[model samples]
Target chain A: MILTVTLNPTLDKFYWVDHLPLSLERAEEEILIRARKSTASAGGKGINVSIFLACMGVETVAMGFLAGHTGQIILRDLLEKGVTANFVWIEGENRTNVTIIEKGREYHPVKIHEEGPRIPSHAQEIFLRKYRRMLKRAEYVVLAGAIPPGVPDTVYRELTQEAKEAGVKVVLHAGRRPLWEAVKVGPYFVKPDVREELMVGDMPVRTEGEIIAAGKRAVEYGCQACLISHHVTGDVLITPEGIWEYEAKVPLTKFKNLVGADDALVGGVLYRLARGDKLTEAVRFGMAAAVASAEVEPKMCLAPAAIEHEMRAVEVQFKEGL
Target chain B: MKARDLMRRDLTSVEPDTLIYEVVYLMEQSGLSTLPVVDEEGKLVGIITEHDLIHAALPEYFDMLHSISFLPNLNQIQKRLKEMAFRPVSEYMKEVTSVHLDDEDLHIADLLIRKRLKQIPVVDGEGHLVGVIRRIDILSRLIR
Candidate 1:
């Protein structure tokens, strides 16, 4: 079973307008267009992973710290979607990440990320104890997203060590300090988006070669395999043997939202791994899921049929002498 | 109309491993003849009703092997009643008759009528328990 750790969870609210009211002097001066509440669901990297895994019939459990009414709603929704949840309750309300999407211009969506509840040091200890207990039974322990306040960056490093000691495979997905710290734990898989410049081992990763170098560097840090996802140029899989790059075969379709495709890619690959797929097949499967998810709405995940279609278009080549 | 539009969100269900004594307490308190059983993920896996309880509580019917006499063993029956109260409901709950919230109106209506069920648990797209719809909820709408 897959266990996802969402250190900080949020209640996401989406407000769609024809155009955001840039300025309003009075009620009459307000930009008048029909506004609607699109959707509000559980929001967190680990929570999304759990939801996607549950959607694909995987037995996934999501653990984290949540609080107040927002936490209650997130818990209820996650349970209703068939994902088991064991969340520690805190005193403050969870955060909300509001996205103001323009109807015709979702490409440039405005995101408002609130600073989540400030967790106490005692709560950190409680969560750590819970995570250790969960790691005993978890086969794949995913350390997801950013660490919240009062939780040190070393949290992932320590948990990674605990998971490694328990013989549970670890998949690390984070950026900057947290990612760098956990790199010393030798995770099974590390996904760094190559589209963004991720400084892995003091190297600024930009091009395909740099991305491969970054993956290789992660492998030096004790990662078994590393997956580098490119935004438009496609994705790459780096291992000791060779570097396999995948060019997406996505058909032309008006993408509803491509914002969460990276997260979907992680969920899809983990889903395949949980089912005992080989490393290569898992990467290919993940690429298919990523492309398929980008082709449709974020709510609709990549299904097998779409995966098949996307697979036909994806060309994976193992480049030698890299 | 969709099943979710009319389904009651306040659910009263139990886990598969809940003790029979607690099951009896919950059922009696809720006044429900049939109760849905869910897993840790809250997926509707089975249902335990008064009938299942009766089947366990009273040894009216027996699958007991190689009985010389047709007479009911009062001692054995009493022993079963006593032991069943502490046993887990996983062995008793029946896994049948669950509807998805997005199920077609005709299909859910037919399933309910044909099965002679008062209500059934409503599952979401992922087959997790969401709510329940009773016959009275439909009846009230039809009459109105």
Candidate 2:
């Protein structure tokens, strides 16, 4: 079974409007914006991946720190989707992230995120205990998403070390400090969440040359493969053997929603890996899944047939050296 | 606490064509006391509960019996179970009593108490199953 850890989970709520007001300067009085439609679901990088994996008939267990009413909703969603839930309940409510999507501009949704509740130290200890026991059952453990307040930055680093010690492959899918700290432990796979910025430990990945350079730096630290997002429709994969770039044939206009596409990609790759597929093949399938998810209205496309259909549209260009 | 806030949006349901045995298996696996039955279009049609399954397994004269000595052997229940296992969920599904998304908490609680319901399905204007409000879900708020 694959184990996914989402340190900070949220009840993601989306609102669809005809047009989002760019400025309130024209308003003379109070403004009341009406949404055409709305939807809510559980979210967090690891949680999203587990949800995707479960939809594809993969046996996955989602672990995380949950709290209050929103956490209850998140847990219920996981169970409903057939993903086993093992969460550490803490005080305070889980965050509710809101995204406002415009009619024709679904790809560029306005996001409003909340800082999750502070996890108590005792709760962290309990999580470690549960995580240790869960490691026995997990072939791969995904340490993804941001760390909640009151938790140390080295938490993912420690988790990676523990999973490595247990001989379980670790997939470090995080960014900034957490990614930097955990990558030092030599995770099996690294997927940086660079939505906020294109930098990895002071190394800017703005240009193709910079991305390859930063990816190579991660490989030097012993990551089997490091994936970095490029141009919204493509990704750069750096492995010890070589570098490969995957670009989806679909245009930017085809993207309906990109919220959980990255997570779908990660889950798809892990699902194939669990089925004994080679790393490159798994990554190829994962990229297709991401494209499929991005092209759909839902946060993540759960249909295997649709994903397979998108696989043919992915152009894999391999660069043998550098 | 309104029905919209109290109801759990994340839940599992079964299709009407699903076998009784499969429903029971799902209930056992999910540890759910009650399961909603929805049509192909996701419309809330009926519901099945553990109580309903238990009642289905009992002999027709069970309610009339005054003594345990008249009870049948385990073989009788096994036989009944075997026969009912293949039956479709539509055959055993009960008429679902549900609440609208805009309903008040007091109204939902009253319905649950008056009808002795373990859980109440939450539906949209078109009778689509959107969420579920359970007795435990309401009680859980007290501790929180």
Candidate 3:
């Protein structure tokens, strides 16, 4: 069974409209009268990954900080969706992330990211203790996304180190400080976009070659594999066997949202890896999942069919000179 | 057994001024028998139950018609039903009640049962509604 750790989970709300006019009062009637679409789903990087894992018929447990009414909603939604959630109850209200789409127009899409509830020290301690107990049963532990304010960046690093010592493969999907700190403990896999890598290393990745080179450097820094995802260019996979570059083949389609693409990639990669696929195959599947995710409407969990179609079209080519 | 141990953590509450129809929908959606009414400041003010709703569904002249009724008049029934369907929750809800939190002692249950209350609002120290502890919550704990 896979164990996904989301330090900060959220209730994601998506409000969809054909087009959002610049002026509020003038456009209010039209936006409301037109085909208005609104949906609320349980979200957060780890939870999204667990949901996809469940979709793929894998047993997964989502553990994290949850609180208030929204927290109950998250737990209820997870149970209804068949994903087991073991979260530590905190004091404040769970944060909400809203995605406002102007349908096909890129200029009008508004994404409001809220900082999640504060986790008191006692709750944080309880979470660490509970997570350690749960890690005993997990084959793969995924520490994902932004750590809420009160949580130390070293938390993920601590979890990664413990999981490795306990013989559980740790897959980390995070940005900047947490990602940088977790890598020091030698996680099984680290997935970060080019921007995150540049921020952590204080160096820009100007091209595909530089990105691939940077990924290789990440492995040298202690991660078993570094998977670098580039929005337009595709993904670069660096492992002990060598470097493999997978170029995304699917054409850019109408995108609904890009909120959970990284989570989709983590799910895709973990799904294949846990099933015994080689590094190259896992990276290919992961990239396909992400590209497939980016093409769907906002807040839509990546459908398995979308992943399958993208996987069939994905083409990976090896560059010369190891 | 304390109220905290058996109170339903997942509660569906409504504002004191919410429309009765919306409360009915919320009741159906949440599968709850009663709803706690709260003020904007999160203080519990009242509670509404299904029985109160049924009473609110009766004709204004229901008492007058009782002397002659083999069957109530259709117009009166229709008017009563419409009123019941649209009345605000505040109009029908029972105001003022004993409320306790999970951390409170089991003696709170004894006091509530002796007072003939079906339910009590489980509130935090600040008086915000957190959940509701019914007679069943206590009964279940006793059985356990």
Which pairs, if any, clash in model 1? none
The chain B TM-scores of all candidates, as shown, are 0.82, 0.93, 0.77
Error of 2 at B119 (Å): 16
- B32-80, model 3: which lDDT tens digit per residue? 6788877655567888987688666665565777543655466765666
Ranking by lDDT: 2, 1, 3
- For candidate 2, give the DockQ: 0.02
Question: lDDT per residue, candidate 2, A29-99, as tens digits?
Answer: 65677999899999999999999988898878888788777887888788778786766666688999898
**Candidate number with greatest DockQ:** 1
Q: What is the DockQ of each candidate?
A: 0.03, 0.02, 0.02
lDDT of each: 0.75, 0.86, 0.74
lDDT of 1 at A79: 73
Report the CAPRI category for model 2.
incorrect
TM-score, model 2, chain B versus true chain B: 0.93
Best by lDDT: 2
Interface DockQ of candidate 3 = 0.02
Candidate that scores best on TM-score: 2
How big an interface RMSD has model 3?
Answer: 12.8
RMSD of each: 11.4, 15.0, 14.9
Q: Once superposed on the true structure, which residue ranges of model 3 sit more than 4 Å away at CA?
A: A22-35, A106-108, A193-198, A298-302, A320-322, B1-144
TM-score of chain A for each candidate? Answer: 0.90, 0.98, 0.90
